[model samples]
Target chain A: MIEGRYFYPHATRFVAARASAASGMLRVEALDGSLLNEAPAKSLRLSPALGRLPARLSLGDGSHFESDDRAGIESLRRELKLRAPGGLLHRIERSWRGITLAVLATAALSYGFVAFGVPFIARKLAEATPPSIAVAMSRQTMQILDGRALAPSALKPKDRARLEALFRKVSAHEPRGAGGYTLLMRRGPGVGANAFALPDGSVVVTDALYALAKNDEEIEGVLAHEMSHVNHAHGLQRVYQASMIPAAIALLTGDVSQVSQMATVLPGILVQSAYSRNFEQQADDDAAAILRAMGAKPSRLGDLLLRLEEVHCHKGGCAPSWLGSHPETAARVERLRQETGK
Target chain B: MSGEHEAAVESGAARSYPFQFEGTGGEYFGIWIVNLALTVVTLGIYSAWATVRTRRYFRGNMVLAGHAFDYHASPVRILIGRAIAFVLLLGYNISLNFSPYALLVWIPAFLIAVPWLIVSSLRFNARNTSYRNVRFNFTGTLGGAAKAYIFWPLIAMLSGGFLMPLARRVRDYYHINNHSFGGRPFETEFTGWQIYSRFLIAFAMWIALMVAFFTFIAVSAKFMPHGKAVSPNDIAIMAPLILMIAFLEIGFIVVGIATMAMIYNLALGHTVLDGRHRLRCRLNPLVLAWVVITNTLLTLATLGLFYPWAQVRYTRYFLGRMALEATSDLDEFTSEAFGTQSAVGEEIAGFFDLGIGL
Candidate 1:
């Protein structure tokens, strides 16, 4: 028997009553021994018991019973042979060890998903994306940059042609050949030597970058790195991976304030840096291979990278480019120097 | 028994009934962590069900006048909505990456859909909530939703923020006046002037904090020895002071919380249910701010393990500050049959992080 409240169908009127499921019937009675309700026990539907909250029994006629005594309610359900949905889940919730395992597993799964699953999925998606879309994205980006910062190249016609010829050589080595690849030269007035590959294989190199290079070997090496970026469609893959961030954050803390989530910014940056770091390393290795194929020492690329960094910074340290940054830049240079020895 | 029952009737003198939340942080944590783990393990396929469980748990623990509230949304319905929302989100993200001009398409599409979505979400939540076998409901129309969520806010912004207080009043009225308990309406009323007063106070507080922050920073900088490297002693002394100053800089949150509390108190205090019982909210803004900011800091510090506790704490404090001023027996309401609402609007609103405007 459970002492609880019994409500009539579709009514807020409730009687403080005692209910008992005995034999094949359930009966609810007031304290005066007058019966309030009676139904076949099997007809009752039990709301899942959660925490120490009240458990409710629906009589299917909209009449229901509610009791705070969870044990009494569970026993009543058992006697009636009724299933309590979410019963298994609540039982696990009530156990400390289960909760502990849940926490650890959640952490592991989230980390594994972000670190491996996102990258793998994004790479597949990037590969599947049509080339027309990439071309549009690249064109829009370059147009915006042109209006905002980039100017027409100031390089002599001879120098521009020579660089374009080297760019074609690297493009020819790619499986797609040189048909789609193009060398876009622009002068960045205030911004120092810069170079980057767009999704549609437009490698934009600033005039200062060409001026900063010591020799043709250095220029060829950098061109190979940019070609690798274009060949692998790294820009599109980065965008796809970036698009997963807000969704992941929404899942984790759907209702949390932005202030509290501010703490996640550093970790989020670290994850992104980790991604770009891997890409930088791959481009470095690919550049090394291409330089060897061109019969030039890989150290020429390393020397030019160090010189570019020096030109980038007038004070403390040159801001790291998307291609490479400090510690990582040092590591890539060291690897290229090793390639030279071999 | 009839004589005793008759004697239990009130003489129209109001009595206050406080809402009690009986959930413990530890117990809720167990449920929360497990829900999150399952959602992750299933690769987000189970989030719809998880959301329902979490909402049910919260509703079940809130007791008013010895009866607990209940939430009864079907997980299957929610799952269908979530699947649609996920696809839409992926489409939006992909198109945006494909071209910035995608905004030209999405922004208008979203604006047109938002009114219907807001109304649907409100109706869905209300229809799923019940007390003593009688359901709560919202009878808001899309026209009302558009007026409150879109047109009013637009007018306020276009008016150089001068009409914001009026917009808040209109929005709150739209939310509160549309709600029904067991087929009886709840109506709320407040003057634009009242909200404007609160806004003024908030603005003043923000300005004061900005001044205080700069003053504190300048004072601290003054105390540092000029032309000398800081010693270990100074570093130790200044570190905690700097941390404290930085924490107080979340002062913006203080003003924001206070303004929210003020609005809540005004809206709830003036609310009348079936034109009989009244609702009251007496939140002291400073104290609520302290609780909220501290809760946020702790959640951040613990990397969100304290989230369940923070939610429980917030519920306890919020409900503790509310009371139902009843002038008669509270059991005469009857439910009206309403069709179940699809979860599409609710799920899409949630996906976009839209608050329910309540």
Candidate 2:
């Protein structure tokens, strides 16, 4: 007789069970001086055992028998020789060696996923995204930032028009059919001396950046860098990669329609330039190529970087929080100067 | 002495039904590690099952009066509930980005749903739990729960947290009055003013701590090495700053632990179960603080492998202090064999990471 509790659909009854090996019939009786219905042993489905946790045997007729008596259950299993498969999970739980292997495998897989798998998937997905969606998102972001950190350009109209004309001339030199590229001038002390590209083919040049640049070529170098970011959809890729872990979590938990929070978080990550070191290097190389194609000096961007660093680093040697994720300025300048033969 | 003392002494001479925890750290460690590994390998898809396995292990090992408790929550139900909760949370987060007005609407909407979630979580947990052929039950109403968990807390917060003890009283009363084992309600007579008086002692300790912190800061500033703009690079000035910072961190930790211990001891000492069964939990703040600090340090040093050991050590220490007195036989209680509870609310609360066991 097996010692277990028989949980009826509406009540719990502690019961004794007897299994007939020949006819494959199982009989259950309540231990509290009562009787229970007999059922075929074939109807019972056994759940996998984990350590001392009781295995649940479902009779599939609105009744369940749970027992911690491993010896009795094992003997019954042998007598019946029924095919009660535990799958991969049970195999791992059954022994210490399997558990160790599982742990090692899990650690390795998680590392690989985080380090390589997520970024790879992000890149592929970003590449597949329509350019129109990125453009619309970019417009929305600029509208949000306009009243917050930015204002109408304080630079003279001629100066603004000249830079806009220069940007159009450089962008038109090579048309990849990305879209019509536009130049936006903003007086943004909050963003002080920063230039960033929007996926909607808009290159924003802050007035602070113009004041820092020594000449038109230096400003052109910054514009080239921003343009490359837009050209490669780097902003979109960064957003996708930053949201990967949460997206994976949502997918695993069967939360398919929860894209709203991701939308909210995406803008911040994009503005912060949460790109991997590889993405940064790729954008820098592309910027250099674009500068060369424009017949402009590539080393001016490097010189501008050094000038900006000297001005900003004097205050306790701290970079502004906006530039926190950028590659080290010193190393980047050195590499760019090498490419420029300066 | 008193009538209660006499009855307690008489019962003490009879069978003392001491709650026993038969789980060992080493045995639990194997299960915990395995569950973590499986959950990660499955990319968190197996967490529903893992939760069940973990609860089962803990409940199965807790023995009271020669019978162990049982947890029979279906993983499928939990999975469905989790999915719904995740979607709602995601939607809420997304709505915040849609517009400022959306955020204004979302916060209150979620708050309004809290009372319902609390009720569902309680009912789900109670229905799933059974001991010796009897199931536990909760019959708390929505309005009562809302008053306890939300409105009272809001009033307390609006009053600079001074009325928190009153809120605690309301919450405890709601919880204890509604809780039942085998259709018999547990009675509590502990008053709100008693809780407030106890909390005042803790409030005084906080004031003392603040005074001490400011005094230490003043003393440190006075004793700081006077020189021509002594930089942090100077070893003479740096040494004292490092020592002072470490000392302040330790003091903060102690104050935090002491406050928690005081509140815990006060609550446990006042709680009564089944009218006849009274609980007395005597915990020393200093000892508890030391245990917690040491446990954290050890767990970190072992790279989190010592988690199960730390958990078991803490549980044993906390539960060991609790002494329950029963005036009558425990076997006489019988739960009603009707009513089915849905696991949706429990799953939703768990998924959204809300406080439920409170």
Candidate 3:
């Protein structure tokens, strides 16, 4: 026997002698032969045993009657059927395509802005600044600093020797054209424990940072990482672009009006900015290569990263202000671990 | 009985619409609200389970031409796919900065990862089955599923602003053409202008209401009596001030309801279809008004006890009144278990666990 349940229409007769259009306490039933009395009638249900069947029920005067006119009922029943489960899969499939298209569209749109919009804006900004005044201002500032009676003339003999040794160690296995490397150790007002690399190939490691290092290797790791930035020419590129281009524009365009404004914001534009993650990775790779070439363990970098992480804990994963343009200590540590397979 | 007699009985049954729809103990709404709440609370983890529950309910209860519906989704596949996507996104971001040129490679890699997900979902869903007296069939392709990704961003972007109407049109178009069953095809079309105009009017109304509300607030504050010292005149004026404030509150409630109605009407459009069966989507103004008023009072009075009931009532009214026209010989089945109270606990639990809407 082909066993199947059929939902039969429930017959409702209003006991009220008056024919009222209002429907209250309607009765309904399930295909499984379960009766639901005085239930609100929102949807009709029918379960069939064999082929398709269609019939409509009439509602009027507090009475419900099934009509032979199954045309409307069948269509309505079909409409009410639950959407197939495959529809979800179908939606997912469509979503995948939609995501791909969206990604491409976003890329295209961003590329358009970067390639066209940025250049246009740059040109406009350049047109607003003159080059000569910017050059003179920078030159004058350098002269003023140079003429300062408080500025130390040159490093002490022992400090010079140490700086020379550090430079040699950092540049020993540096990749060609990665970046030019320089080391500057000078005595001035104590700036706390800090180390920084300027865009002009100048790496300043304060005496306080040297005091904090557990050993020379940790210091070497720091120098190697900074050397990688130099070898990559990132520092020079940033400095040249930041200083000269704007200055040149200012001088050429004869617009020193925004020069003061630019000067005020320049430190923010230059300092403690983040390099791209990819750049960080590349620098990590470069540093790793340098350490390998110098016959030193790459784990030294990872160790330094951990120490830095502890130091920068309160800064929400950011490096200290001196190392602002660098990756967070946690990221640096992770990258080193990944590279060294430790 | 002979096969022919069996066929006749099935055919007859398939054609009957006798107000015989079953109630799944309000599990539908329970699950919906639960999932919605869970999604809100859990920050969307409950969505996966919610999706499964939704599929189970719809599959278990649906009857068409005497046939039931079946659905399936693999949690493992979904989880794994999500993990892989997350990892890839992380890697892609890293690659983007170090070598901006590397984005070229990442783009294609991202594209390739998508089809695996689409195919897995399709295979799992199609294999799930339901049958009445007749055999049920499920058919779909990877290409169809993959197309979804193409439109989703457009939908997202369009939904954000004046482009909502265009977005709705695209959504309607995609939804209509994306299904097929029993050798029959389903399709729908919506004009962009219709959606756009509706949204514009709704936005305008919202803006006007906001303006009026602020104006009333400003005017009331300005007119409120202020004096150097507390006196009989100042005390006497407080009664009218309180009344005016009460009146303003009522006005805000009315305006809020009107805004919700306008938004609902604009976003969903007024028509929906399951295959060739077309249903005119009508927003019952009266029902909407009751819901708005009742919801406002409930929220104000009980601090929110009546929220669930309000939700159930509105959902019921909307789902119940939607009428579908029959265009084919197959029996149509409708289910309305919107206001029943089954699985509410599960839903609430899921909502809390998922931290859904936050």
Candidate 4:
């Protein structure tokens, strides 16, 4: 008769088996009290004794089996070691499930925001823009406002020739007026040094801005930038947004009275209607590309930006009029410098 | 020795089985179901408790040479460890977002955080187990944890593109060099580079098969006589859909078989120096086939209600069939105490009445 321990680490199970050999007949009983009748000449055969336990065997008369009462099963376990099995999927399954759930939850939450958030912000911005800034005027109305005679007066031949050349050069780019953009450069009294693009893409530059330019490159750089605002349809987008505000408010409240209430805050809205930093950067890049295509040194824009910043800094509290409707001079200067690689 | 034999003869003593078997196969399913239910109800708070319960069951029921294995973990300690990990993760995220130079702060933070987590896990595992007047202690190295984190993710990404052979390499890598209590380390002589090439070949073959499948569908659709307004556009859309479904079905089968193969490879890698402690698992193609078929049918039939049950059955069958061999000194006996406490266990027990005498 022989007795020994059998360890199975993966299942975390341990078993003890007893065998008896006599008269060339051997009978082996498993730890769970099940009997095994078959014993091959040099092998041990197991039976399905324990519920889920599989059978095992040993060869060569089982001479390696030992019997000890003092040591107990624990000591036997120490002598024969077993390793626990590890699974790759089992380890990472929880993490994968967690990430997947989080992504789904985030998507569910963000769906509501996308459905309502963007339009709401756009409506608020539109309510802020002034109607006077948004609406366009007829060419006849503009001529009447300028007090021009019904019959135009003849101009001096040299002055007329110069005026025609200027008009030809300006119109060659074919600046579209779908958004009611109109360029007006004039030498007017009390109109300080300035050049600005209105929400309607109407670029109004004073004669002082032409005098401030060191050469035609700087003048052309400013012209190209204003043209980009028109070409890119930024003005039309603004007007459409300005019109959408009251409509959205009406949709939300089902009342038209709020539109008048919103009109009182229009000036404050226009004061804050500056383009986003990304938009300004895009305009600067476009201007640099256009000026370069027109055979001009794009850095001339950088020089103008530096002069504007210096003037704004010297004024301390007050900025140059051109600095309005845009970022601070320092910021614009840095952007232009980056664009022109200066 | 002769005297001992004579004593045995004189006393008429008979040899007894070395292990104590008190396990009931079906009881574990009940526990698994219950644990799963509790986890679902508690919204994952039961995870820590479940871990403790699982460790206790597996340890308490294991019978070796008439002695039972035992393990106990402090839930409070585990909870505290998790809390610390959460705080560390938050700090790491903050640093990543706010630091001017992330390279200076974020990388070190991650390195420290990962090692801390690994150490905590090992400590928890060690403090949970008790055996024969000696409590188990964890002695994991930080270097190992770092290596595991760095290489495991890379392996996951690489295997996604080259699944078949890379899967084998990953299995072998995990099994190799795994050390146990009896000074037995796992062995795998295969290299990853060799498996990578084989995976590339397999991937190419799979792509070719996919192309052929699409071509067959296209050719068949083109040859069919038009009864109605059959346009090439219609064929184009229908062909892709049919090919997609066929591809998914075949992919599931391949993945299922590959999973089994990886398991078998892992088992083969585990071996003790004395040759007694060993494990050998054979990939049962029929078992994998049944899993794929049953899962597909269940998805079609119960609309996923039977998913949990299918999962439990699959796990039970695979685990039950696993075979282990050890030296004569160590005994093998299972007890109901080791059964997991989760909802899946109950469902399994209800489906298959193994009556694991709990």
- The true-versus-predicted C-alpha distance at residue B32 of model 4, in Å, is 4.4
Off by over 4 Å in 3: A1-342, B1-51, B62-68, B81-160, B224-276, B285-318, B331-358
**If both were scored by DockQ, which would come out higher, candidate 2 or candidate 3?**
2
Candidate 1: tens digits of C-alpha lDDT, residues A1-342 = 799988876566777888898896788888777998888876788887678877778887878887878888878888888888889899889887898899999999989998899899889998998999899999999988898789999999999999988888877776568887889999988666888999998999999999999899899889888888888888998888777765565555444353445555655666676787777778888888888987889989899888876665443343344423333556678999999888
User: What would the DockQ be for model 4?
Assistant: 0.03
Q: List each candidate's DockQ score.
A: 0.37, 0.22, 0.02, 0.03
Q: Write the per-residue lDDT of candidate 2 for residues B131-236, one digit (tens) a residue.
A: 7545667778889888998899999999999888888878877876787665655556566677776677766766776787678778877887576565545667
Residue-by-residue lDDT tens digits, candidate 4, B1-358: 7587446535634332233334443444333334444443453345455555545555555554445556646545544554454344444433332222545766767776665565456545643454432234444456655656545555666776444455455434443444223222334445666556545544555576678667867887676667865543454655766677777667645644555444454435343323334454554655655665665466346532343355445444554444444433332212221222121121111111111100
- State the DockQ, from 0 to 1, for candidate 1: 0.37
For model 1, how does the per-residue alpha-carbon lDDT over B1-358 read when each residue is reduced to its tens digit? 7465334425446778898888889989998899899989988767777878888888888989877888888666566655655566677887898788899999888787778767766777787787765677787888898899999999999999999999999999999999877666799987768889999999899888878777877887787769976543455655857676776667776887899999999999889887767898999999888888778778778877888898888889989899997766665433221222111121222233222211
lDDT of each: 0.78, 0.66, 0.45, 0.46
Q: Candidate 2 chain A — worst ten consecutive residues by lDDT sum?
A: A253-262
Q: Identify the runs in model 4 with alpha carbons over 4 angstroms from their true place.
A: A1-342, B1-43, B55-71, B81-112, B115-123, B126-139, B151-178, B182-212, B217-243, B249-253, B256-260, B263-267, B273-276, B289-311, B331-358
Model 4's CAPRI class is incorrect
What lDDT score goes with residue B174 in model 4? 41
The most accurate candidate by lDDT is: 1
True contacts kept of 2: 0.22
The true-versus-predicted C-alpha distance at residue A29 of model 2, in Å, is 11
TM-score of chain B of each: 0.83, 0.81, 0.49, 0.56
C-alpha lDDT of residue B269 in model 3: 40
For model 3, how does the per-residue alpha-carbon lDDT over B1-358 read when each residue is reduced to its tens digit? 5586446545643233211123243333344444444443443344555555555454544443333454434444433444444445445643343334667897677566554454444334433332221112223344544445545555657567555555545544444454333323345555567556666655666576668666866887676657644333344555555566676665555554554555444433433334434443456544676665665465346423343354445445554444434444433322211111121110211110111110
Residue A152 of candidate 2: its Cα lDDT? Answer: 86
Error of 1 at B204 (Å): 1.3
Candidate 3 lDDT by residue in tens digits, A1-342: 111222222211112111111143233333343542222334332322111122222232222323223344343334444123333322332354533443344345434543444334434543443444333433443344435522442446775676568667677666533235556664334343455554345566666566556766667777877766654555333332333233322221121221222232443343314323334667777777677677776777778667665554433334354446556666677777676663
Candidate RMSDs in order: 6.1, 6.7, 22.1, 24.4
The reply for model 1, stretches above 4 Å from the true place, is A251-270, A304-327, A338-342, B1-12, B213-249, B332-358
